[model samples]
Target: MTLLEVSDLRAGYGDLQILNGIDLSVNDGEYVTIIGPNGAGKSTLMDSIFGLTDHKGGTVSYDGEDITGLDTEECIRRGMNYVPQDDSIFPTLSVMENLKMGAYTESELSDEKLQDIYSRFPILEERTAQVAETMSGGQRQMLAIGRALISEPDLLILDEPSSGLAPHLVDELFDKIDEINADGTAILIVEQNAEEILNRADRGYLLTEGKMQREEGAEAMLADEEIRQEFLAG
Candidate 1:
Protein backbone atom coordinates (compact mmCIF):
# COMPACT_ATOMS: atom_id res chain seq x y z
CA MET A 1 0.00 0.00 0.00
CA THR A 2 1.16 3.49 -0.68
CA LEU A 3 2.02 5.31 2.52
CA LEU A 4 2.70 8.67 0.91
CA GLU A 5 1.35 9.80 -2.48
CA VAL A 6 2.04 13.01 -4.36
CA SER A 7 0.19 13.72 -7.59
CA ASP A 8 0.89 16.45 -10.10
CA LEU A 9 2.81 18.42 -7.48
CA ARG A 10 3.63 22.00 -8.38
CA ALA A 11 5.38 24.08 -5.75
CA GLY A 12 8.02 26.75 -5.21
CA TYR A 13 9.30 29.48 -2.99
CA GLY A 14 7.24 32.69 -3.08
CA ASP A 15 6.88 33.51 -6.81
CA LEU A 16 9.58 31.17 -8.17
CA GLN A 17 8.39 27.70 -9.15
CA ILE A 18 10.56 24.62 -8.66
CA LEU A 19 8.65 21.38 -9.14
CA ASN A 20 6.34 21.18 -12.16
CA GLY A 21 3.61 18.55 -12.32
CA ILE A 22 5.65 15.87 -10.58
CA ASP A 23 4.26 12.67 -9.15
CA LEU A 24 5.87 10.37 -6.58
CA SER A 25 4.98 7.80 -3.94
CA VAL A 26 6.47 5.69 -1.15
CA ASN A 27 4.92 2.43 -0.02
CA ASP A 28 5.24 1.16 3.51
CA GLY A 29 8.83 0.07 4.29
CA GLU A 30 9.99 0.84 0.77
CA TYR A 31 13.32 2.53 0.03
CA VAL A 32 12.96 5.25 -2.62
CA THR A 33 15.67 7.54 -3.91
CA ILE A 34 15.52 10.59 -6.18
CA ILE A 35 18.68 11.63 -8.08
CA GLY A 36 19.53 14.27 -10.65
CA PRO A 37 21.96 17.01 -11.59
CA ASN A 38 22.36 20.16 -9.59
CA GLY A 39 19.32 22.52 -9.60
CA ALA A 40 17.04 19.68 -10.67
CA GLY A 41 14.59 20.50 -7.84
CA LYS A 42 15.14 17.24 -5.99
CA SER A 43 14.98 18.98 -2.62
CA THR A 44 11.98 20.99 -3.71
CA LEU A 45 9.94 17.82 -4.13
CA MET A 46 10.79 16.82 -0.56
CA ASP A 47 9.99 20.30 0.73
CA SER A 48 6.61 20.16 -0.96
CA ILE A 49 5.74 16.83 0.59
CA PHE A 50 6.82 18.08 4.05
CA GLY A 51 4.83 21.35 3.65
CA LEU A 52 7.90 23.56 3.69
CA THR A 53 7.27 25.06 0.26
CA ASP A 54 4.57 27.32 -1.18
CA HIS A 55 2.36 24.65 -2.68
CA LYS A 56 0.77 26.02 -5.80
CA GLY A 57 -1.13 22.87 -6.74
CA GLY A 58 -1.33 19.09 -6.37
CA THR A 59 -2.46 16.73 -3.64
CA VAL A 60 -0.22 15.10 -1.04
CA SER A 61 -1.80 12.18 0.71
CA TYR A 62 -0.26 10.29 3.61
CA ASP A 63 -1.63 7.03 4.98
CA GLY A 64 -4.87 7.53 3.03
CA GLU A 65 -5.43 11.08 4.35
CA ASP A 66 -5.08 14.25 2.36
CA ILE A 67 -2.19 16.31 3.77
CA THR A 68 -2.01 18.97 1.12
CA GLY A 69 -1.23 22.41 2.50
CA LEU A 70 -0.78 21.10 6.03
CA ASP A 71 1.82 22.84 8.14
CA THR A 72 5.11 21.14 9.13
CA GLU A 73 3.90 20.40 12.66
CA GLU A 74 0.71 18.84 11.36
CA CYS A 75 2.74 16.73 8.94
CA ILE A 76 4.90 15.54 11.84
CA ARG A 77 1.83 14.76 13.91
CA ARG A 78 0.66 12.55 11.09
CA GLY A 79 3.82 10.37 11.33
CA MET A 80 6.10 12.10 8.82
CA ASN A 81 9.67 13.23 9.52
CA TYR A 82 12.15 15.24 7.46
CA VAL A 83 15.93 15.52 7.78
CA PRO A 84 17.30 18.21 5.53
CA GLN A 85 20.75 18.21 3.90
CA ASP A 86 22.14 20.88 6.19
CA ASP A 87 21.64 22.41 9.62
CA SER A 88 19.43 19.55 10.80
CA ILE A 89 20.81 19.46 14.33
CA PHE A 90 20.92 22.05 17.11
CA PRO A 91 24.58 23.01 17.26
CA THR A 92 24.74 24.09 20.89
CA LEU A 93 22.68 21.24 22.27
CA SER A 94 24.16 18.05 23.68
CA VAL A 95 23.48 14.82 21.82
CA MET A 96 20.98 13.65 24.41
CA GLU A 97 19.29 17.04 24.45
CA ASN A 98 18.87 17.01 20.70
CA LEU A 99 17.18 13.63 20.82
CA LYS A 100 14.98 14.79 23.69
CA MET A 101 13.90 17.82 21.68
CA GLY A 102 12.76 15.54 18.88
CA ALA A 103 10.00 14.20 21.11
CA TYR A 104 9.01 17.61 22.44
CA THR A 105 5.70 17.52 20.59
CA GLU A 106 4.78 14.33 22.37
CA SER A 107 3.85 14.08 26.04
CA GLU A 108 7.23 12.58 26.92
CA LEU A 109 10.09 10.53 25.59
CA SER A 110 9.97 6.82 26.24
CA ASP A 111 13.02 4.84 27.28
CA GLU A 112 12.29 2.18 24.68
CA LYS A 113 12.51 4.71 21.86
CA LEU A 114 15.67 6.25 23.29
CA GLN A 115 17.29 2.85 23.59
CA ASP A 116 16.32 1.95 20.02
CA ILE A 117 18.01 5.08 18.70
CA TYR A 118 21.15 4.38 20.69
CA SER A 119 21.30 0.83 19.39
CA ARG A 120 21.00 1.97 15.82
CA PHE A 121 23.82 4.50 16.28
CA PRO A 122 26.17 3.29 18.95
CA ILE A 123 28.47 6.29 18.63
CA LEU A 124 25.57 8.44 19.67
CA GLU A 125 25.28 6.45 22.89
CA GLU A 126 28.94 7.09 23.73
CA ARG A 127 28.61 10.79 22.93
CA THR A 128 25.25 11.40 24.54
CA ALA A 129 26.64 14.22 26.65
CA GLN A 130 28.89 15.67 23.96
CA VAL A 131 27.94 18.96 22.32
CA ALA A 132 26.56 18.52 18.80
CA GLU A 133 28.69 21.41 17.51
CA THR A 134 31.91 19.68 18.46
CA MET A 135 31.21 16.39 16.70
CA SER A 136 32.59 15.42 13.31
CA GLY A 137 30.41 15.96 10.23
CA GLY A 138 29.42 12.30 10.00
CA GLN A 139 28.59 12.11 13.72
CA ARG A 140 26.36 15.16 13.44
CA GLN A 141 24.52 13.52 10.55
CA MET A 142 24.05 10.39 12.63
CA LEU A 143 22.64 12.48 15.48
CA ALA A 144 20.26 14.20 13.11
CA ILE A 145 19.00 10.86 11.83
CA GLY A 146 18.83 9.46 15.36
CA ARG A 147 16.78 12.43 16.51
CA ALA A 148 14.32 11.97 13.65
CA LEU A 149 13.93 8.30 14.51
CA ILE A 150 13.06 9.17 18.11
CA SER A 151 9.59 9.97 16.89
CA GLU A 152 9.23 6.53 15.26
CA PRO A 153 7.87 8.04 12.10
CA ASP A 154 6.20 5.86 9.47
CA LEU A 155 7.96 7.76 6.70
CA LEU A 156 11.38 9.39 7.05
CA ILE A 157 12.33 11.83 4.31
CA LEU A 158 16.03 12.55 3.99
CA ASP A 159 17.65 15.12 1.72
CA GLU A 160 21.30 14.40 0.85
CA PRO A 161 22.13 12.37 3.92
CA SER A 162 25.56 11.65 2.41
CA SER A 163 26.43 15.17 1.43
CA GLY A 164 29.66 16.74 2.70
CA LEU A 165 30.81 13.55 4.42
CA ALA A 166 34.20 11.96 3.90
CA PRO A 167 34.05 9.23 1.24
CA HIS A 168 34.61 6.43 3.76
CA LEU A 169 31.96 7.78 6.09
CA VAL A 170 29.37 7.84 3.31
CA ASP A 171 29.21 4.06 3.21
CA GLU A 172 28.88 3.91 6.98
CA LEU A 173 26.00 6.38 6.86
CA PHE A 174 24.22 4.39 4.18
CA ASP A 175 24.61 1.30 6.29
CA LYS A 176 22.78 3.05 9.12
CA ILE A 177 20.02 4.09 6.70
CA ASP A 178 19.67 0.50 5.50
CA GLU A 179 19.35 -0.66 9.09
CA ILE A 180 16.65 1.93 9.73
CA ASN A 181 14.62 0.83 6.69
CA ALA A 182 15.03 -2.81 7.62
CA ASP A 183 13.28 -2.04 10.91
CA GLY A 184 10.27 -1.00 8.77
CA THR A 185 10.30 2.79 8.39
CA ALA A 186 9.76 3.79 4.77
CA ILE A 187 12.59 6.00 3.41
CA LEU A 188 12.47 8.69 0.73
CA ILE A 189 15.89 10.14 0.05
CA VAL A 190 17.14 12.86 -2.29
CA GLU A 191 20.82 12.28 -2.79
CA GLN A 192 23.70 13.65 -4.84
CA ASN A 193 25.60 10.38 -4.64
CA ALA A 194 23.49 8.74 -7.31
CA GLU A 195 25.39 5.49 -7.85
CA GLU A 196 25.57 4.55 -4.19
CA ILE A 197 21.92 5.31 -3.58
CA LEU A 198 20.85 3.50 -6.74
CA ASN A 199 22.78 0.44 -5.69
CA ARG A 200 20.87 0.25 -2.42
CA ALA A 201 17.41 1.61 -3.17
CA ASP A 202 14.47 -0.56 -4.09
CA ARG A 203 13.28 2.04 -6.60
CA GLY A 204 14.88 5.14 -8.07
CA TYR A 205 13.63 8.24 -9.86
CA LEU A 206 15.65 10.50 -12.09
CA LEU A 207 14.62 14.15 -12.14
CA THR A 208 15.75 16.84 -14.54
CA GLU A 209 14.80 20.49 -14.69
CA GLY A 210 12.12 20.02 -11.99
CA LYS A 211 10.41 17.00 -13.54
CA MET A 212 10.76 13.25 -13.19
CA GLN A 213 12.56 11.96 -16.23
CA ARG A 214 12.62 8.30 -15.39
CA GLU A 215 11.44 5.84 -12.77
CA GLU A 216 12.65 2.25 -12.50
CA GLY A 217 13.96 -0.43 -10.21
CA ALA A 218 17.40 0.34 -8.86
CA GLU A 219 19.20 -2.54 -10.52
CA ALA A 220 17.60 -1.97 -13.89
CA MET A 221 18.61 1.67 -13.86
CA LEU A 222 22.12 0.71 -12.87
CA ALA A 223 22.35 -1.78 -15.74
CA ASP A 224 20.95 0.53 -18.39
CA GLU A 225 23.80 1.71 -20.57
CA GLU A 226 21.98 4.87 -21.62
CA ILE A 227 21.29 5.91 -18.04
CA ARG A 228 24.82 5.05 -16.94
CA GLN A 229 26.31 7.06 -19.77
CA GLU A 230 24.04 10.05 -19.36
CA PHE A 231 23.56 10.32 -15.60
CA LEU A 232 25.82 7.86 -13.81
CA ALA A 233 28.96 9.08 -15.64
CA GLY A 234 29.84 5.76 -17.19
Candidate 2:
Protein backbone atom coordinates (compact mmCIF):
# COMPACT_ATOMS: atom_id res chain seq x y z
CA MET A 1 0.00 0.00 0.00
CA THR A 2 1.11 3.53 -0.63
CA LEU A 3 1.99 5.49 2.49
CA LEU A 4 2.28 8.86 0.81
CA GLU A 5 1.15 10.23 -2.54
CA VAL A 6 1.88 13.60 -4.15
CA SER A 7 0.21 14.24 -7.48
CA ASP A 8 0.79 17.13 -9.84
CA LEU A 9 2.35 19.30 -7.15
CA ARG A 10 2.98 22.84 -8.33
CA ALA A 11 4.52 25.34 -5.93
CA GLY A 12 7.06 28.07 -5.44
CA TYR A 13 7.84 31.41 -3.82
CA GLY A 14 6.01 34.63 -4.74
CA ASP A 15 5.19 34.28 -8.46
CA LEU A 16 7.96 31.98 -9.62
CA GLN A 17 7.05 28.29 -9.81
CA ILE A 18 9.77 25.98 -8.56
CA LEU A 19 7.93 22.66 -8.66
CA ASN A 20 5.89 22.16 -11.80
CA GLY A 21 3.46 19.29 -11.85
CA ILE A 22 5.60 16.97 -9.77
CA ASP A 23 4.29 13.51 -8.90
CA LEU A 24 5.77 11.12 -6.37
CA SER A 25 4.55 8.16 -4.35
CA VAL A 26 6.28 6.26 -1.58
CA ASN A 27 5.14 2.75 -0.70
CA ASP A 28 4.99 1.39 2.80
CA GLY A 29 8.44 0.68 4.29
CA GLU A 30 10.22 1.63 1.05
CA TYR A 31 13.35 3.74 0.89
CA VAL A 32 13.02 6.25 -1.96
CA THR A 33 15.25 9.13 -2.88
CA ILE A 34 14.96 12.18 -5.13
CA ILE A 35 18.10 13.79 -6.54
CA GLY A 36 18.63 16.68 -8.87
CA PRO A 37 20.74 19.71 -9.66
CA ASN A 38 20.97 22.66 -7.28
CA GLY A 39 17.85 24.44 -8.60
CA ALA A 40 15.93 21.30 -9.41
CA GLY A 41 13.17 22.26 -6.91
CA LYS A 42 14.00 19.21 -4.80
CA SER A 43 13.67 21.01 -1.48
CA THR A 44 10.70 22.97 -2.73
CA LEU A 45 8.89 19.73 -3.41
CA MET A 46 9.52 18.58 0.13
CA ASP A 47 8.39 21.86 1.63
CA SER A 48 5.25 21.83 -0.45
CA ILE A 49 4.33 18.31 0.61
CA PHE A 50 4.84 19.23 4.23
CA GLY A 51 2.69 22.38 3.89
CA LEU A 52 5.52 24.86 4.18
CA THR A 53 4.85 26.43 0.78
CA ASP A 54 1.90 27.62 -1.24
CA HIS A 55 0.34 24.69 -3.08
CA LYS A 56 -1.07 26.29 -6.19
CA GLY A 57 -2.70 22.99 -7.03
CA GLY A 58 -2.11 19.40 -5.90
CA THR A 59 -3.15 16.64 -3.60
CA VAL A 60 -1.04 15.29 -0.76
CA SER A 61 -2.42 12.17 0.81
CA TYR A 62 -0.98 10.27 3.73
CA ASP A 63 -2.43 6.84 4.35
CA GLY A 64 -5.32 7.61 1.98
CA GLU A 65 -6.26 10.82 3.75
CA ASP A 66 -5.97 14.11 1.89
CA ILE A 67 -3.70 16.30 3.95
CA THR A 68 -3.56 19.02 1.34
CA GLY A 69 -3.57 22.52 2.83
CA LEU A 70 -3.23 21.09 6.33
CA ASP A 71 -1.18 23.12 8.75
CA THR A 72 2.29 21.88 9.75
CA GLU A 73 0.93 20.61 13.03
CA GLU A 74 -1.81 18.70 11.24
CA CYS A 75 0.76 17.16 8.98
CA ILE A 76 2.75 15.88 11.96
CA ARG A 77 -0.34 14.75 13.78
CA ARG A 78 -1.18 12.59 10.80
CA GLY A 79 1.97 10.50 11.36
CA MET A 80 4.14 12.38 8.86
CA ASN A 81 7.41 14.04 9.85
CA TYR A 82 9.51 16.38 7.71
CA VAL A 83 13.07 17.45 8.39
CA PRO A 84 14.02 20.46 6.34
CA GLN A 85 17.27 21.00 4.47
CA ASP A 86 18.59 23.29 7.22
CA ASP A 87 18.01 24.69 10.72
CA SER A 88 16.32 21.48 11.87
CA ILE A 89 17.52 21.69 15.45
CA PHE A 90 17.29 24.22 18.27
CA PRO A 91 20.78 25.59 18.70
CA THR A 92 20.51 26.61 22.35
CA LEU A 93 18.69 23.51 23.55
CA SER A 94 20.57 20.58 25.05
CA VAL A 95 20.60 17.35 23.09
CA MET A 96 18.09 15.67 25.41
CA GLU A 97 15.79 18.69 25.32
CA ASN A 98 15.83 18.73 21.52
CA LEU A 99 14.82 15.07 21.31
CA LYS A 100 11.99 15.56 23.76
CA MET A 101 10.68 18.50 21.72
CA GLY A 102 9.81 16.30 18.76
CA ALA A 103 6.98 14.71 20.70
CA TYR A 104 5.49 17.89 22.06
CA THR A 105 2.08 17.02 20.69
CA GLU A 106 1.93 13.82 22.69
CA SER A 107 -0.04 13.90 25.94
CA GLU A 108 2.50 11.74 27.76
CA LEU A 109 6.09 11.98 26.56
CA SER A 110 8.15 8.99 27.61
CA ASP A 111 11.73 8.92 28.80
CA GLU A 112 11.78 5.34 27.50
CA LYS A 113 11.35 6.76 24.02
CA LEU A 114 14.35 8.98 24.58
CA GLN A 115 16.40 5.98 25.73
CA ASP A 116 15.34 4.05 22.62
CA ILE A 117 16.56 6.89 20.42
CA TYR A 118 19.80 7.24 22.40
CA SER A 119 20.41 3.54 21.83
CA ARG A 120 20.14 4.14 18.09
CA PHE A 121 22.49 7.11 18.34
CA PRO A 122 24.99 6.57 21.10
CA ILE A 123 26.85 9.78 20.31
CA LEU A 124 23.69 11.60 21.31
CA GLU A 125 23.66 9.66 24.59
CA GLU A 126 27.16 10.89 25.43
CA ARG A 127 26.24 14.47 24.57
CA THR A 128 22.76 14.55 26.06
CA ALA A 129 23.47 17.45 28.36
CA GLN A 130 25.46 19.48 25.85
CA VAL A 131 23.99 22.31 23.84
CA ALA A 132 23.17 21.47 20.22
CA GLU A 133 25.24 24.43 18.98
CA THR A 134 28.37 22.93 20.53
CA MET A 135 28.25 19.73 18.49
CA SER A 136 30.22 18.88 15.36
CA GLY A 137 28.52 19.02 11.98
CA GLY A 138 27.92 15.30 11.69
CA GLN A 139 26.82 15.07 15.30
CA ARG A 140 24.29 17.85 14.78
CA GLN A 141 22.87 15.99 11.81
CA MET A 142 22.64 12.86 13.89
CA LEU A 143 20.80 14.78 16.59
CA ALA A 144 18.40 16.17 14.04
CA ILE A 145 17.62 12.68 12.76
CA GLY A 146 17.41 11.31 16.29
CA ARG A 147 14.95 14.03 17.23
CA ALA A 148 12.75 13.23 14.26
CA LEU A 149 12.74 9.55 15.18
CA ILE A 150 11.57 10.42 18.66
CA SER A 151 8.19 11.18 17.16
CA GLU A 152 8.09 7.63 15.74
CA PRO A 153 6.57 8.95 12.57
CA ASP A 154 5.12 6.51 10.08
CA LEU A 155 6.90 8.34 7.28
CA LEU A 156 10.07 10.39 7.69
CA ILE A 157 11.23 12.92 5.15
CA LEU A 158 14.92 13.85 5.32
CA ASP A 159 16.10 16.74 3.18
CA GLU A 160 19.78 16.65 2.27
CA PRO A 161 20.64 14.57 5.33
CA SER A 162 24.18 14.07 4.07
CA SER A 163 24.95 17.63 3.10
CA GLY A 164 28.15 19.20 4.51
CA LEU A 165 29.58 15.88 5.68
CA ALA A 166 32.97 14.42 4.88
CA PRO A 167 32.90 11.41 2.51
CA HIS A 168 33.29 8.89 5.31
CA LEU A 169 30.63 10.58 7.41
CA VAL A 170 28.26 10.55 4.46
CA ASP A 171 28.73 6.81 4.24
CA GLU A 172 28.05 6.42 7.94
CA LEU A 173 24.92 8.61 7.73
CA PHE A 174 23.58 6.59 4.83
CA ASP A 175 24.22 3.46 6.84
CA LYS A 176 22.07 4.90 9.62
CA ILE A 177 19.35 5.84 7.16
CA ASP A 178 19.29 2.28 5.89
CA GLU A 179 19.16 1.02 9.46
CA ILE A 180 16.18 3.28 10.15
CA ASN A 181 14.39 1.96 7.10
CA ALA A 182 15.20 -1.59 8.08
CA ASP A 183 13.46 -0.99 11.39
CA GLY A 184 10.36 -0.26 9.26
CA THR A 185 9.99 3.53 9.02
CA ALA A 186 9.62 4.49 5.37
CA ILE A 187 12.21 7.07 4.26
CA LEU A 188 11.93 9.70 1.55
CA ILE A 189 15.20 11.52 1.19
CA VAL A 190 15.98 14.52 -1.01
CA GLU A 191 19.63 14.77 -1.87
CA GLN A 192 21.95 16.50 -4.34
CA ASN A 193 24.80 13.99 -4.03
CA ALA A 194 23.55 11.71 -6.76
CA GLU A 195 26.44 9.29 -6.61
CA GLU A 196 26.24 8.65 -2.88
CA ILE A 197 22.46 8.58 -2.56
CA LEU A 198 21.97 6.43 -5.65
CA ASN A 199 24.29 3.84 -4.24
CA ARG A 200 22.07 3.38 -1.18
CA ALA A 201 18.52 4.20 -2.28
CA ASP A 202 16.24 1.27 -3.02
CA ARG A 203 14.75 3.38 -5.82
CA GLY A 204 15.73 6.78 -7.16
CA TYR A 205 14.09 9.61 -9.06
CA LEU A 206 16.00 12.14 -11.10
CA LEU A 207 14.34 15.54 -11.01
CA THR A 208 15.38 18.23 -13.44
CA GLU A 209 13.91 21.71 -13.83
CA GLY A 210 10.89 20.70 -11.72
CA LYS A 211 10.18 17.54 -13.67
CA MET A 212 11.02 13.89 -13.09
CA GLN A 213 13.56 13.00 -15.75
CA ARG A 214 13.98 9.39 -14.77
CA GLU A 215 13.06 6.73 -12.21
CA GLU A 216 14.97 3.50 -11.70
CA GLY A 217 16.85 1.34 -9.26
CA ALA A 218 19.65 3.21 -7.54
CA GLU A 219 22.31 0.80 -8.76
CA ALA A 220 20.93 0.79 -12.27
CA MET A 221 20.99 4.57 -12.46
CA LEU A 222 24.56 4.53 -11.24
CA ALA A 223 25.42 2.05 -13.97
CA ASP A 224 23.79 4.02 -16.78
CA GLU A 225 26.34 5.98 -18.76
CA GLU A 226 23.87 8.69 -19.80
CA ILE A 227 22.63 9.18 -16.23
CA ARG A 228 26.19 9.22 -14.99
CA GLN A 229 26.93 11.89 -17.58
CA GLU A 230 23.83 13.95 -16.80
CA PHE A 231 23.79 13.86 -12.99
CA LEU A 232 26.74 11.90 -11.58
CA ALA A 233 29.43 12.40 -14.19
CA GLY A 234 30.86 15.34 -12.24
> Model 1: residues >4 Å from true position, as ranges?
none
Candidate 1: tens digits of C-alpha lDDT, residues 1-234: 999999999999999999999989899999999988899999889989988899999899999999998998888899989999886999999999999999977988799999999889999999999999999999999999999988889999999998889999999999999988998999999988888899999999989999998999999999999888888889
Per-residue lDDT tens digits of candidate 2, residues 1-234? 999999988888878888888889998998899988888899898898888888788798999999987998888888878888765899999998898888887865597998888888899999989999999888999999988887788899999987787777987888888899999999999986778777777899889899888888888888989888878864
Give model 2 RMSD, 1 decimal. Answer: 1.2
> Could you list the CA RMSD of all candidates, in the order they appear?
0.8, 1.2
**Residue range with the least summed lDDT across 10 consecutive positions in model 1:** 101-110
Q: With candidate 1 superimposed using the best TM-score fit, by how many Å does residue 88's alpha carbon deviate from the native?
A: 0.4
Question: What is the TM-score of candidate 1?
Answer: 0.98
Q: How many backbone clashes does candidate 1 have?
A: 0
Candidate achieving the largest lDDT: 1
What residue pairs are clashing in model 2? Answer: none
